[model samples]
Target: MGEILLPLLILCPLAASMIVSVSAGRMGACAIGTVACTGVGISAVISIILSITLLSGPPAGVLQVTLWPWMHIAGFSADIAFMLDRVSMVMILVVTIVGLLIHVYAAGYMRDDPGIARFFGCMTLFVAAMLVLVLASDLLCLFIGWEGVGLCSYLLIGFWYNDPANTAAARKAFYMTRMGDVALLCGLLLLATATGSLRIGAVLAAVTNGQLAPSGVNLAALFILVGALAKSAQIPFQTWLPDAMAGPTPTSALIHAATMVTAGIYLIARLHDLFAMATPIMALTAILGTLTLLMGACTALVQSDLKRILAWSTISQLGYMFLALGCGVWQAALFHLMTHAFFKALLFLTAGAVIMRTGHEQDIFRLGGLRHAMPGLSAAFAVGASALAGLPLVTAGFYSKEMILSGVWHVHFGLTREWTLSGHPLWGIALLGAFLTALYIFRCVFIVFCGKKQGTSATGRTSRLMSIPLGCLCFLSLCGGVIEMPDTLPPLHLFSTLLDPKTPLSHADEPIWLVLAGALAPLAGLGVAWVLWGRATPVMHEIPGQAAIIRLARTGWGMDALYDRVFVQPFRLLTWLTHHDVLAHAITATGRLTQAVSGRIFQARTGFLDILSIWGSRGTGWMAYLLGQLDNGRVRWYAAWIAGGLCAGLAMAVLS
Candidate 1:
């Protein structure tokens, strides 16, 4: 039964989405919601069953299902094949489970909106695309899924296309990711040229057999890294994500927490061996991850909007995953990715509840004293924030983030003798980012739910549908880390061990002192936040010299402006030249050349024609005068003239 359902997992949601679109007008809101939930629910069930089957066997187990030959041209061929490997199995369950929950939440969140059908359709399509991306057996199939999700993101982000801001945001997200997509395609072509394989299994198999050259693998990994970074919204490619909150909160959870943003991590994880083949690329990736982690944490500190804060937090957490991958501890990265998904979804949903309750007010400065108004959701928010802050041993984030920091600590210690040494800057940046993450999150918590309410606010109750998922996610956020216990005492390392201790996992065995520092870092951050903002009211403006600093953080370190001036503006100029300058000038020049040639032809015709006409009239007059003279019939004169004329005519005739 599991085998029968594994292949249809992606299709279930897709089919349901299509049915909803067709029946949207005929169906009521409840019916449409039911259809959407049912489809996702079915896929989630299949994922669980298939996971059980694989988990029951050896961790090496993989379920490969081939639908048909998708393409065959010359030597290059591919199938619509899916692989349920251990890593992909994790992704499948994560996408479906988290995705189904988000869909249910969206049903309640967007209940009153008339465009519910459009939202649900796009949501399910995204779900389908993500599942395919994670499960794809070949680069060709993965690209298909990759493109599908990009399209869906554009549609869903601009779900409220009436607003120009939303449209612009949708365009930003689409075009920004498009740059990485182009690089990704180029990398795929290069990989295919080097190895002549599109199937990931064959590619990895070739790597295992030591068939690929080092330089080619490194180049391929670099280009793919650019795509991953852009898709996952890391560093320079991260500008679009915060703006993407112009979409609804459910969309935020869907894109940021669980599905689209994690694609980069999954891609790197999927091609784990290829990246491992080139250590320099991994180091470079680690550097990017560390810098982005701090960048996000810094910017998140000053953000006023609740969703934007979470958005930046998502960026920071994703950087940790990237850091882990770069350090060659992909198991830690994957664990963090899973745990981050849960808490982030919970946080976003709870924030959505707050916004709904307070008349869609998202500004932390304006919202306050919500601890009493929405006690249930407020408690839920606290759970999520605690998990995100990575405070101590109780939360899921503590274990996962500590795993990443543990890897960083090991790297630092390996480079320098002392564990506390600052020789390796990534270790320092990651730890500091952890502290800032806690401070900023709790700061928002203190300002919103703990401070005084600014004014009269509306009240909207959260439905049981929304409440139930929040409760489940809240429980999971608190306890999910137990899956892989840290080694302060007897630890399980269950998540790491399940991936097998043959390669990277064996070294990731229960990190020691790093967990201790990581544990304290968040506690200190929370303490500072409590002291500073716990009793203080929100301020309207920045303090004199602090304005510049605040502006820098608010502008995401001016990355957007830099990209605009560097890439977007330059590209726009080139486009303008093509349409309005270069192309037009070429056509205008061709016309001028034709006109010049015509003017020379006109000169040759008209000027010489006038001269010839004058000469022709003069010659006719001379002939008439000679004819008149010949007719005069003067005896002697006529005889002499006639003889002269005959001699001249005979001489001319002979010469001729």
Candidate 2:
């Protein structure tokens, strides 16, 4: 039953995608959307049933099914297998349920577009790939889905390929993520070589039992970490994400906000045991995550475009998840990942509605006093913003964020007691990021929805299809974190215990002040936002002659410009220098010389064939004579000659 169901879960959406692709020009938008949604809806139902069965069966319950052998070469093997444990259950639910909602919303969001069929086709295919990524039991098999999402992302991000900027954004995303993919492939090879298998269980067991050298473990972990960083858009690789807003809003919601960007977190958490043994890499992860969190928050604070703000916010939120993983509180990271998906998806979808109705106006400063005109949308946006800001006690973001903060505060990593890395500084930075998160997101909310009407006026009302998903996500954004609470709240470790029964997450002995600090950071940020932009006369437009620091923050601290000068300029220079094909010319010269030499040689070879034939006949006669010497009358010599002839014949047959 599990085997049949597991394959069905992937095949449903995959088959739908194929159908849509093959019948694209012949199908109407409604038919396309219905087919896409129905496929995901069925997968969602299967995921729920699987989740219920896993939870009800046992603490260590897992449903694994191998449909067939994926590959077998020499000493290497992999299987087309699926595994549904607690971690995957959470991921599948997020991928399918959130993915379905986005599809439903996209139906209305893209209703009038001519390429609606293509959009649905890529969207459905993306969901199927994500499902494969989360469910695979073998690392090699997981990579198939890993690359699958990347390809789908490229296609969807460049869906409107007529626009040069859109295609450029797509290419940029592809190239940058490919860098990390290369590193990830190297890491997987290292693990496979050491463990002699790519199965997740075997890899983890080998690492835990000291089958790999210390250096090997660290290098593998480090390589995988680099891949995750690029995928998740951590610092130094984050420029592509903001530009990714060139895609459609639902694309942003599905790929950037909910699923694809979180692939790194999932990969790391899935191999937590391997990471645990590499403490230095763990520290590096935590440090890099902290820097990205702070940088993304600061960059988001000054963005005027609506989607770019959310893009940076997604980067920042993922940093929090990475920080938790680094601190060894993976459950906290996964919890935040779930909640972030809900609110972030809600925000993107709601923003899409606002953009569509307001004549596609994306500049927040140019739009104002929208709450009175679109009360429901304004309300939904507020819910998403509050959850993103972690407004205490009421929002899902607060609980998950609090879990991360608590986990960071108590974490200690080092080679020795005196040289240990403490989490106190990281906790402080995260809190600061929290305040900035509230300030930036609420700043957008206030400037867009709180004051007098200004630039672009509302044009159309949001359709029921888009509104329904908004309402569902709004509810989820506020209530999804109840399954995990802090020490100060009613004790509930449902999320932690469900993920791992042996060591359920707890912050029981921590002081009460930590929770209070986490709760206050966002509240204070909200108060500050109200003072700045939430007034009757809101600060809606960009100020003239902005300070240098303000300009820097707005430009993502000039990281793109720096990268261009440091990397892009040098490469372009090299390309230009080689544009005339000097090496190719040199090779061409050599080829011409060879051609001339061969021409002369051919002219002199008129009788060479006959001479070569005579030499070959003589050589053959000599070899036959030597073989004839083995025909001595002794039975032993004859038997040996026969066996040699048979072995030579068998070798030729096999080779042929």
Candidate 1 minimal-lDDT segment of 10 residues? 412-421
TM-score for candidate 1, residues paired by index: 0.87
RMSD of 1: 6.5
Model 1 misplaced stretches (Cα beyond 4 Å)? 412-423, 456-458, 501-512, 536-547, 573-582, 589-656
How good is model 2 by TM-score?
0.88
- TM, every model: 0.87, 0.88
lDDT per residue for candidate 2 within 192-308, as digits (tens), equals 888888999999999999999989999999999999999999977998899999989999999999999999999999999999999999999999999999999988888889999
**Candidate 1 lDDT by residue in tens digits, 128-241:** 999999999998899999999989889988999999999999999999999999999998888777667789988877766777787788888999999999899998799999
Q: Candidate 1: lDDT over CA atoms? A: 0.86
How well does model 2 score by local distance difference test? 0.93
What is the lDDT, from 0 to 100, of the residue 633 in candidate 2? 75
Model 2 has how many clashing residue pairs?
0
